[model samples]
Target: MSQTILITGGAGFIGSNFIPYFMTAHPDYKIVNLDKLTYAGNLDNLKEVENNPNYTFVKGDICDETLVNALFDKYDFTGVIHFAAESHVDNSITGPRPFINTNLLGTFNLLEAARTHWFDAPNTP
Candidate 1:
C-alpha cells in the first residue's frame, strides 16, 4: 500500500530540499506539498520534483482552518511534516505579530487537525 504524506511549507528552503530527497528515498510514499508561497517560499526551489508522479503542490495558508481540514479529508495523509514558519530573526524583531500568527497559530491548527483526525476518533476493530 502506498503512503500519503503531507509536507507543509514545501516551497521554503528546508522543505523544498527535503521534499525531493524524501520522495527519492521513499518511492512508495506520495507527497502532498502545501505552501503559502511567502517571500521565502519559492516554487523555483522545487523544480526538480515539479512533474513527479508521487508529488503534488498546494498553494495556501496554514492559518486557513477550512482549507486545512479539506486537505486532510481529501488526502487522508498517513504523516505530516510541518515546516511552515516565520524564521527570519530580523523580521521577527521588526514585526513580531506575523511571527506569532504563522509560527504559533499555524502550528496549532495543524496539530489540532492532526490530533482530531488521527487520534481522537474511536478505533475500528
Candidate 2:
C-alpha cells in the first residue's frame, strides 16, 4: 500500500531538492508539501515535481496547529520530513521572534500532530 507523507518547507532550497529525489526513489509515496513561502522559499525551485500526480503543494505556516492537525487527519500521513525554519542568521539576530516561533513552536506543532495521529497512547512504542 502507498503511504502519504508530509514534507514541511518543501519550497525551500534543501527540501525542494530532497522532494524530487525522494519521489523518484519512492514512486508509491504521496507527498504533501507545506510551506509558508517565506523569503527563503521559492515555488519555482519545486517546478520539477509540480506536475507530478503524487505531489501536492500547500501554502501555509507550520505554526498553525489547526491547519497542521487538519492535514494530518485528511491525509493520514505516515511520516513527516520537516525542513521549515527561519534560517537567516542576520535576520534571526535582528528579529528573533519569527525564528523562535517557526523553528521551535512550529516543529513542536508538527510533532504533536504526528504523535496524535500515529500513536494510540502517550509513550507507547
Candidate 3:
C-alpha cells in the first residue's frame, strides 16, 4: 500500500527543493503538492518532478477551507509537510493581511481538515 501526503507551498524555494528530493527518496509514497503560486513561488523550480507518477500539483490557497477539505477527502493524506508562508519581512510590515491569512488562517484550515478527515471520520473509505 502506498502512503499519500499533502505538501503545501511546494512551488516556493524551500518546498520546491524538498519535493523532488522527497519523491526520489520515498518512491513508495505519493505526494499531493498544494501551492498558491505566489510571486515567490516558481513552477520552474519543480520541473524535475513534473512527470513523476507519484507526484501531483494543485494551484490553490491554503486558506480555502472548501478546497482543503476536498483535497483531504480525495487524497486521504497520511501526513502533511506544510512549507507555505509569507516570509518577506518588509512585505509583512507593509501589508500583513496576506501573511496572516496564509500563515495563520491557512494553517488552521489545513489542520481542521486533517483532523476532521483523519480523526472524526476515520471510517471514510
Candidate 4:
C-alpha cells in the first residue's frame, strides 16, 4: 500500500510550492492535506493536486484535538509534514493570540496526534 503523508498548511505559501513537487517525485505516496484556510491559504494554490487520486483535502483547525485524533484514526498516516504555523509577524503583533494558538498549540496538537497514532507502529517514521 502507498504510504499516507499528512501535510498541514498545504494551501499556504511554502507548502503550496512543496506539495506538488513532493507528489510529482514521490508517486508511491498519498497525501492528506489539512489546512485551516487562513487568509494566506488560497485554494488556487493547490489546484494542481486537488483532484488527484492520491490527494485528499480536509479543511479544519489543528487546535481541535478530537478532529486531529479522528483524522489519524481514519487515515493512519505514515508520516507528517507539519507546515501549519501562523507565521506573519505583522499579524502576530496585533494581539498575537491567534498566532500564538495557531502556531504553538496547533503544533502541539499535531505532535500529540502523531504520537498517539504512530508511537507503537514500527514502520512509522
Per-prediction CA RMSD (Å): 1.2, 2.2, 1.6, 2.3
Candidate 2 residues 11-70, lDDT tens each?
Answer: 998999999999999999999999999998999988889999999999999999999999
lDDT of 1: 0.91
Q: Where is model 1 poorest over a 10-residue stretch in terms of lDDT?
A: 116-125
What's the TM-score of each model vs. the native? 0.94, 0.94, 0.95, 0.92
Q: What is the C-alpha local distance difference test score of each model?
A: 0.91, 0.94, 0.93, 0.90
Model 4 misplaced stretches (Cα beyond 4 Å): 120-125
Clashing pairs in 4: none
Ranking 2 against 3 by TM-score, winner: 3
Query: What digit string (tens of lDDT, one per residue) describes model 1 on residues 39-116?
Result: 899999899999999899999989999998889889888899999998897988889998999999999999988987
Model 3 agreement with the true structure over 1-30: per-residue lDDT tens digits: 779999999999999999999998998999
For model 3, state the Cα shift of residue 17 in Å. 0.5
lDDT of 1 at 73: 85
> On a 0 to 100 scale, what is the lDDT of residue 24 in model 4?
97
What tens-digit string does per-residue lDDT give for candidate 4 at 1-125? Answer: 76999999999999999999999999889999999998878889888998899999999989999989999999888899999988879877767999888889999999988887778656757
Model 4 per-residue lDDT at 88: 78
